[model samples]
Target: MIRWNVVLAGGIGSRFWPLSTPARPKQLLPLVTDAPMLRDTLDRLRPSAPPERTLVLTNAELRDAILALEPTLPPENVVAEPRPAGTCAALAWAASLIARRDGPEAVMVCTHADWAIGDVPQFRDTLDRAAETAATTHALVTVGIVPSRPDTGFGYIQPGTAIESAPGAAGEVRRVARFVEKPDQARATQMVADGFLWNSGIFAWRVGDLLEEIAALTPEVQPALVAAGTNLERFFADVQSIAIDVGVLERSARVLVLAGQFGWDDVGTWAALHRVRQHDGQDNAMSGPTYALAASGNVVHAEGTQVVLYGVNDLVVVAREGLVMVTTREHAANLKTLLDAMPAEVREP
Candidate 1:
């Protein structure tokens, strides 16, 4: 039994441009299905915990918009980060709050709000198991997806030794040998062959255990514990920016990874629609007033207008009121480069 808190919803998500604006990011868009990606994430967690226990950490600029989108959650539960201090600070802050409200024994399951899990039941089961592993082992646990393909986009986790079988379950808990960032094509293929699991960025830990790990591994946010109530803004401003994976999980000695079988995909780019969304017979993902002809393996999303595509293969086509973007699906992951190359006036709405 764990109380989960989700984060990283304020991003502009330029990879899903046109539909994804500064006012409404990808998490707020119905990228995969009818509901927004954030909404889907919240719905998935409902079986494990209620809205009161689940906190949403996001930027101040998008706070009101997020609240408007998810009016069901308590306004207070929607935490507005004073600044973008990265996951190390954000997770530390959320863990501190959970420890204060609930007891330090409270287990917190942390995840991003913009992912797509194919099987809801398996997702819940894996998360519940991870929570148990965290509570009993007192170790920081991360869910590693059983890779179905050699995905170079996601990080890889190497399992060390099996700790114990998950009480009557088929597979056992395992010690994490090492964490590897996104690798080259050959390395990714070899890793898949070597039984590597995709690092799903799903984490579980006791509030107290995580706080202690932050104190030991991440000195950047350590001071915030004392300044939390007094000067929150100054505390966030002063902390060094780092992700939890780099600051704590990678350095900490007490880390474990559990193999997750549920279909998981981090819909981080336009190209990811192929993995998460329903495709046609020719392998095209069409959404929001879109029609494809002679377009194989393409992703087309129209925000408020009709988009007609023809003779385009492996392309990402998007059309909205103010803008339209057309590019190869292979280049969809690197939209930042396109944004960087564009003029500010044209880029900004």
Candidate 2:
């Protein structure tokens, strides 16, 4: 029933400060491989959803760049958000477009443009399962990654009672017992040990169902949707910025979670490269002609210059555009704070 896909690609990727700027965010960067993350995302989904049926929602400033990345998609398909209304409004608008074109019953698969999925086949399978589950159950569906580690940066979902799949066979389907945001290290570890799943931010739902739930449960974005029909600017101004998880998934009772284990990583910060990128024997993940003599647990991204890490461990080194930044892995995600403290001359181009 999934006839369309809505890809959210508007984030500025503040966590990756030095490399990710307003014009060129992490979504446009080749952090995972040689191609841009957005391009990789489209390519990953093309097998199940064609570019004709896909709609990309991005900021006004980055519309041209996104359209340039995929020429097969019509110019109108690359929609530029009039304002930063967050994911809830974006998804709502996307669902409205799908409903208008494909009818209310058409299922839409929603995902972000900036994610590192290791197993493409398994990843597609999980999404397909989510789409199938949503089609048959007529419920908002989310894919929950089987926790591989105690990641404090991501939200966790506790699964509830099991349910039968579309074929009446018992599947990994379960009602979401609870949703917990980024937690302390102790709590994250305990949750992982207790079989909690990482909130993958992947969703599937019919346009009618999603809109109905939003109208009933999320009042903040519901009014905006009414305005979205006529005036997008007023809609963004009226709605409070809210993520789909908090605005809809957490509050909606008709939500289901499916256990997913396909090597998923958010790649939120520079340090995340160590987890998603391929590493050498020394446990170093490097790109753009780099060598490590004895480095271990270091993530390096070099461009326009060769970088060699000697006997360094747990460090992040980035070289680009004549600017070099070096920081410990633990401090890599804090680059935003560092950028804030830097003078405007040094912070912005």
Candidate 3:
């Protein structure tokens, strides 16, 4: 078993706006299941690690909210970041904590909270292999999801030459050639044809090795890490915003990629419900009482309310207390822009 620390959870997720606010972010919303998304994320790893070993790094404002949702998790394990300094600082802070408490050789796995996994056994098997690979190779191991379709929203990982003598069970290790960000539709199709895997944002690494990579490659947060133990607020104020993918993963030479066959979905936008949830014969995904007439490929979420749609196709309708959002499925990806265009008084809670 490997020690796990989940990063990349502190997101407002404007893509799921109106329903997802700063106080209750996407991770806290019951998007995929009845329980909060974070709870599902934690449950996915329960077989490998216990609640005490799990660490959740969230914004200071949402600490109480996270704690309420997950009462079993230790209070101290729910680390509240002083500010939003991006994934680099978050990972560094988590690594610093783990290294100080545990040892340098202690392997840690990192993942996000707002994700849906269809197969738990496949996911655990992949993580077990990833942990063994990280411990044996002393390198950063990332789970590159086996692409089920041509997805342009996620990054792609190109596997390099295989590590023949790498320790671990069979089919556990492969060298990473490079990391590529989201490409255009045409390019994304070609990437799938070229055997590129979706960058699942799941990572495994040793505490000492990750610290070394952060110190060397990410200067924006290096000083923050050095000053982390003393004052978290001061450290956060001094660091620049940068994601771990740009700061370390892209620059690190010792990165390894393992093909993950488990079904995974980031559940990024309202349109993504078509992939995450079960659709009816009319191609509509309805959570509550929703009657669709001549409508196909629509996502309707009505919380204790009756919704009636007629002659609407490819639309997202979400009805909740003090909020009613109706937008085309194509426009779901641009919800942030829509929120920005609204008045402040209407936008502010």
What is the total number of backbone clashes in candidate 2? 0
| Most TM-score-accurate candidate | 2
Model 1 Cα RMSD, 1 decimal: 1.7
Off by over 4 Å in 2: 165-169
C-alpha TM-score for every candidate: 0.95, 0.96, 0.96
Question: Compared with the true structure, what per-residue lDDT tens digits does model 2 show for residues 1-349?
Answer: 7578889899789877778888999999999989999999999999988887999999989998888889898887887887898788889888887888888899999888989998899999888888888888999999899988898999999999888655234858998999999999999999999989999899999989999999999888898788768565667678888888889999999999988888888988999999889889998989997889977999999988888889889999998876888999999878878987899877775
Task: For candidate 1, write residues 72-157 as lDDT tens digits.
Answer: 78887888877788888888888888888887888999888899989999999988889988888889999999999998899999
* Local lDDT at 247 for model 3: 89
Clashes in each model (backbone N, CA, C under 3 Å)? 0, 0, 0
What is the C-alpha lDDT profile of model 3 across 1-349, one tens digit per residue? Answer: 3476565578788888778889888899888877889889888888888888889989998899988888888998888888888888888888887888787888889989989999989998888878888888888999999899998899999988888667664545789998889999999999999989999989999988999999889988897678756567777888889998898999999899989987899899999988888888898988878898898999988887789999889999998867688999898988888888998876765
Candidate 3, superposed: residue stretches over 4 Å from native? 167-172
List RMSD in Å for every model shown.
1.7, 1.4, 1.6
Top candidate by lDDT? 2
Global lDDT of model 2: 0.88
